[model samples]
Target chain A: MKLLYFAWVRERVGHPEEEATPPAGVETVADLVDWLRARGPEYAYAFAPGAAIRAAVDKRHAKPEASIAGAREVAFFPPMTGG
Target chain B: MAVRLQREPFDAGAEAARLTQGREEVGAVVTFTGLCRRGADSGAPLTALTLECYPEMAEQELARIEAEARARWPLADALVIHRHGRIRPGEPIVFVATLSAHRAAAFEAAQFLMDYLKTSAPFWKQEETEEGTSWVAAKAVDDDAARRWDEG
Candidate 1:
């Protein structure tokens, strides 16, 4: 699957997009986030200690509980307020 | 329909004229202009807004949003103009216009385009404030707005 980052998340992750294969047990979106946070310092910094992160699955905004089984792309970013 | 991703501020009247040209089925026009804000929720003094995007991805995503709007409404024309680079307060940030056979389609199409853009577009904005420059975060309200569209 392709992972896209935006805003500070992209800055922390150090790239705009990358193709990746999630590890075992990373079934849901929340689980995948936990796995991503454990990847490295960049992932940890991007996820941060306690910041509100928003996500989208294939360009559609996704909730934390949303599934990731069929998702070909996933995006993580901070909350946006642009009109 | 024209979807433009540009760095220069757009002229609304000119853009509207461009979209309406050679089209006779368009009976109603709805337009929305988004401008840069001077402050965030904390009321910090803001100087400018710097927008960034993934060049290839931004264009593809915007095209998807416009296509979805057209599928959902009977629009004769749709125009989405988004400006990148640094913009000061009161400067235009984005413009969305929908031309349809009736007011209802135009109105709904405009709203739908804006909602989808808020959630799906890859544009990122950083606010240069007196306190310090900060990257803007996606709001829960925007997620809620986009979610509602799925239910319809």
Candidate 2:
């Protein structure tokens, strides 16, 4: 799946976008987040200790508990405050 | 309604005129242009700000937001333009204009667009500071502002 970062999310994650194939257990957005958190210090820092990061599946806003079974893309970023 | 995402700052005056063009009933025109501030908090000297957004996603989300605004108000027209890439302090970052027959509708729709844009748009700001580069997070105040719409 294609993963994207925005704003500070890219800064924290150290890249603007990337493609990833998650492990079998990563069936949900939460699960994918957990997997990403375990990747390294930067991923951990990007997710932070317990930040309320938001996710979007297929360009529509989604919650962390949302399923990612057939998702082609999942983007994670902090809440937006732009107008 | 028109939704535009550009790297060049927009001319709000020209945009407003264009939106209201050929509309005699549009007695009210309400607009909001978000400018690059020093910083949201302590007024830290803002050297530069960079905005990044997904081109396709941003356009789709913006169209959805504009549709919602029109559904909720009797608007004559609406226009939203946001600038991305590197920006300097005091430069315009966004422009939202609503035209309506009455002041109340124009005002409400304009505010609604701004509120939803803040939470719904994909644009993100990176602030370059003396300490270092910092990613600006979603502000609690912005959420509060959006929440106020639910009260009615």
Q: Give the runs in model 1 whose Cα sits over 4 Å from its true position.
A: A1-4, A14-32, A48-51, A54-75
Best by DockQ: 2
| Per-chain TM-score (chain B), model 2 | 0.94
Q: Is the docking of candidate 2 incorrect, acceptable, medium or high quality?
A: medium
Residues B1-152, candidate 1: write the lDDT tens digits: 77888888878888887788888887899999998877765688788999886556567778888998989998888889888888999889999999999999999889888998887777888888888888876777888878888897
lDDT of 2 by residue, B1-81 (tens): 899989998888888878888899889999999898876444678789888787778898999999999999999899999
What is the lDDT of every predicted structure here? 0.83, 0.86
The numbered model that scores best in TM-score is 2
TM-score of chain B of each: 0.94, 0.94
iRMSD values, candidates in order? 2.6, 1.2
